[model samples]
Target: MGPASVRPAVLVDFGSTFTKVRVVDLRDGSLLASGQAATTTDTALEDGYAAARRSLDPPWDTARPELVKATSSAGGGLRMIAIGLTPSLTVEAARRAALGAGARLIATYSYELTTADVAEICALEPGIVLLAGGADGGNRTAVVHNAGLLAGSAYTGTVILAGNRNAADEAAALLAAAGKGCAVTANVMPRVGELVVAGCRDAIRREFVRRITASHLFRDAAFPVRMPTPMAVLKGLAVVSDGIAGVEPGLGTVLAVDIGGATTDVHSVGAATRRAGVVYTGLEEPHGKRTVEGDLGLRSNATGIVARVAEDPGLATRCGIDDLDRLTAASRQLAAHRSTVPATADQYTVDAQLATAATALAVGRHVGHLTVQHGVTGPVRIQEGKDMRESAGLIGTGGVFRHAADPESILKGGVADERWPSSLRPVSPKFYVDREYCLFAAGLLADDHPHAAFALASRGLEAL
Candidate 1:
């Protein structure tokens, strides 16, 4: 527990599929050793963590550290329900805040919460509920009503009051009086057409850590569990975009695609600009954003990805998957045996194509596009999602990218797809891989030693 002992630290990420540990020289951001073990989801994850510790034998096995930091995506991550004044304004902002904090948004209710809505939320059993409505000085009726409804429900999880400032105190008091845990933060939509997420994002992360700490699963782990795996990675990505001294100066705009067994997540950090004559009509897109595609994955959601591909002509053919039945069967087999690695050339090909499709689909959905239509006043353009044409880097992570012989090809193919409705793409950018799975670890380090975290992350990746 001394400063010298803290020089060497252990950083672990408890992912759904794997438990990874890294021993690092915090002084210079040097990686000493790393190990991995299959995550023990049904039982305590400590078993896997211990196994991983043993796998890093000899010096590391016998060495003592001053710190044990962890980030996790276990148990489907942090599930959250969001309730807001309207679907387009406060509701959307609340959803963004939740997602930015690395929470899986399970459900969103707009306007006043109904008895049926409360019943469904109870059934869903989210770890947290994000209640946001109105603007700073705007309408407070909807947000206050929703708060009272949630307080009277069977749900007893943490409820975050992030709405009209005038009503937040009352909402918090009502929830407290009802024996419900409540936390208050700044309004998600402080003003009409303006989205403020930093406050709610931080609050959500704190509540999620509190919820995770209270669970028996994390009882034996380290304190100050920085954040969820994805959130940490997002923070690390932000660092990459912003740069740190003695590390990367900055990458300008960057896009990252992480393909997991159950979902594909896309994260981007930078400014979004309209190209030529296109005009964005929707709410402003946050510079640092994350989007999770639940139905696009290699294992559990393989069939869903296949079905989407089937809907698109020439996609299967481009992927060299001619037999739809064979592909579907293969996907089901992978789903049933999630740990199985491709043992045959055909299987490997199928995996690469699946990875390609998943990446493409995720990016396509994450990026904004422009559409032309006639308006009462004149012809207008509508834009949706974030524009990434000016991105300076494209990074790929996770099992698919890590195990592939030519992972860059998968990313290249995905980005080159003509089906993309957006004018901006990572058409030309530096490519890198999270070969050592240090993204989350770097994120965990960012809070205390930002420069070291950036340097460690820079040394961890290799150009693809």
Candidate 2:
């Protein structure tokens, strides 16, 4: 590495609650600086962006930064509606496909016969409506029903049909004939239980692109709201894996987990692996992130954590019901409700425990409940046949890890994310989520200064 004191490029992430800034030295991969500011995107986009940008920018008097870039979940991501014939099967498949494409699933319905339901879906005003139902050899009633619903709708959004391959041509024509603008794809639930998500996933992406042009990002065009932040992250991870083993390490392999408030996302990369995916989200439930325990977020889903953990035997003992109740209550206002600074030791313990459980559950689900941990491991990289010890890296992101009181406290929080924090003690470890590190910012770092991304992620992030 040349001069370690070189200026660094910055990555900025504007979330609903916090706007994070991270800097990575491209020459040496050393993380330079990170900071956050409360975000109030709901108030107004122009104002929100102005404040967020200020929060992200280092003191003007400090060192002039290399470059500043950004991504945001503000103004809501892309929104979507999934339509299928069967409530659980095809509709579920459509939901998966939509979510994978980075669209937020707002509603799903199957077609049996429902004029009222059709009216309801139309009123949701989704950016995209994914229509899927029946198998290639199955009945057309469900698909036709959904098509009929969109026939006279005022919504001019993209409608992707991911259903029976045989009916694709007909479905396209039908939806169009019904005055619905539509895109057709093979069945998301192709063969009985088999899900052909690739086609629909592609269509969803197309729809996002089609809609992004008009979103808040562009004042002149339609914008995509409710687009899958996790989906984009997954795609970015795939890009990294492809570049790593295929480009950098030549025979690279890796595993990743993005522990979020509402969900914990897992992605893997390897030579043997052909692609990246969200292996699981709420894979380990009643054990999700503490901050987002409910559908409401820090501002809305605060009560979810308490409600979920209430069912767990672990929380009951580790954190008394009274404490649990308090945190659960506080989580709702987590975004902006600043009150009651943690004073008591027990309060601190509970706060740590709640964050800990969320992280562990997310991490565990990402790696899967490994019956054995001696497969492969590494520092910032991994290789095939390495096993758990060979996992190139275990990256942690999100606010919980970032706002941790200290590194040791973060480690304890890691233990909570994982039932056993010591599970991977022998492996090289570092965490990059401090008041100073942001993954999206680091992801920007990971793009050019991967080594630095590795370094900071190792040092600042809590290691179990």
Candidate 3:
């Protein structure tokens, strides 16, 4: 068959504010056209989807694609609460699995559940409760106790049991007796200091898909929402970082940041390469890591960003803010008017400063750090988190970067410098912009058309 005869596929991302659509030629993974419309999540999602579809150019707008796939973060993504036995081991493991699965981790609790904790969980109303504790053959008492508490609680979310293997059946039976939804998966930490989250991640994704399909918000949409928007982006980054063997060459050690209205998500894919004389500590970092900063956002959390900057005078000055009071007022206005675009020069400057501060703070929290400890012989450097200083490329996405006149300057806020020699942020990496917003689309195509996904991602990015 010739290229002209090959049918394209339509990919849609139901974002919090916008419904983005892309048409990709299945033959070569080339993007044909793209369009976006204000998301009608408060109403019918199909209204926005249809509008975006109609906004496309030429026959592409009218002609039907071969297949349609979708992802969504319209209703604040997949909200989840993770509960575990210990803060350092099981709790941390559950946190990683939840975030890596593209879930918006609302809260995390350690130790046995108390009455107040159960009340808080009920009030939070998460879509999923990630119950993890103990190792595969380790202490099973905590997990079983937690299961009993959750079963008797008013929380209606699905309980994902990724704790002790020995206690799995009992936990499942307890939840089932209460008529609560439960899913049993592999232990998140099968052994001490050993993490096994793939099964849990898969279980989370399955639950996400099930909820999305069942929700009335997306019932009338033409395509089924397959995964969360963050998950789709993560999948695309995986393909970029670890390309198919002999088909596509992977980009080694890559970092990508997505700054949004309510959060800033940082995704890094690669092996953690420790420098000589540095001792790595803490839980082993995953090859593909994603961190979401709920407090760092340009719109809904603008005030939070301003507050963070106020604590660091130097950072505030670097962001071009002279008066904290003025910036604080501007942040309030931005937060109040979520959809308002920067009209005046001062407003634009405020937005830029906030974006810069958000990126810097979010990335700082995401990357690993080095701490020097003085010993008898010499100072020892201890590294915690993933080392991404040697990243090959840094890609910027989301509305802040997409609309900025100088995105490179905003992105530079995340780079490391001599001021703090501990942060392992990317340095001297090539900058790229997701000009076409095809990363999620590429990820949606990754499972079925990997080569095509790689081709689209490669061609869609514009180097700065």
Best by TM-score: 3
Candidate 3 error regions (>4 Å): 1-4, 58-63
Q: lDDT per model, in order?
A: 0.83, 0.52, 0.88
lDDT of 1: 0.83
Cα error, residue 114 of model 3, in Å, equals 0.8
Compute the lDDT for candidate 2. 0.52
> How far out, in Å, is residue 199 in model 3?
1.1
Write out the backbone clash pairs for model 1. none
State residue 82's C-alpha deviation in candidate 2, in Å.
Answer: 2.3
TM-score of each: 0.94, 0.65, 0.96
Clashing pairs in 3: none
